[model samples]
Target: MIRPRRPERKAPPLLPPLKLYKAILRTHVHKLPIELRSLGDEYVKAEFKAHQNIDNPLHIVGFLTQWQDYLKNLDGGSWQEGKLSQEDLDKMSPEQVNQLYELMLETKRLGSEG
Candidate 1:
């Protein structure tokens, strides 16, 4: 008997609900988890991609322009602007937390040195 191999699954696209995406960018974190965070991320990506295509035009041009501006300023450490909450860190086990924090700090140090 021949066995068949299973196909690999692709990561789902990030296309967020319009209102929820705006809310997240607005820093309404408490309400975010009440809905679906993963779904929100998916929707954002999908919308961004859709607007990026030649077929359908959208306001994404402004967003892409801002991203380009940010990239141009990437010589400094502006890439890492946001902070992760202590509550979020505390939820992880000590080993995982230490590893993640160590890697994050190392990345920041390297970015700052350059």
Candidate 2:
């Protein structure tokens, strides 16, 4: 006998990239500290620009999902307490790991300067 099919769960629709980018910059980034606001804005601009030509649905979904989570964290005032889980770090490619390291160093440098 065949097993019954489970109902498919639908994810909430994501905002379009341009709209989400504007929300992050206009609504969220300005709430950050001066140093962090500049850094976050630059990073967000670069990330969005880099992904502008991406055509893969999964990649787009994943990118938007992570950014949406970031927006939520900022809105909730818990963004400063966020940390990368080891499991999430393990999934990064070598280039991504290096990029993360560079960002960390830059953050530290800014922190020391402030």
Considering every candidate listed, which one attains the maximal lDDT? 2
**What TM-score, over all chains together, does every model reach?**
0.28, 0.86
Tens-digit lDDT track of model 2 for 61-105: 999998988887887888888999999999999999999999999
Give the clash count for model 1. 8
Instruction: Write one digit per residue (lDDT tens) for candidate 1, span 1-114.
Output: 998989989643333335334544444233344244344355445655665554423445444543344333333434446465889677778876786676667556655655
Q: Which sections of candidate 2 miss by over 4 Å?
A: 1-11
lDDT of each: 0.49, 0.89
Residue pairs that clash (backbone atoms under 3 angstroms), model 2? none
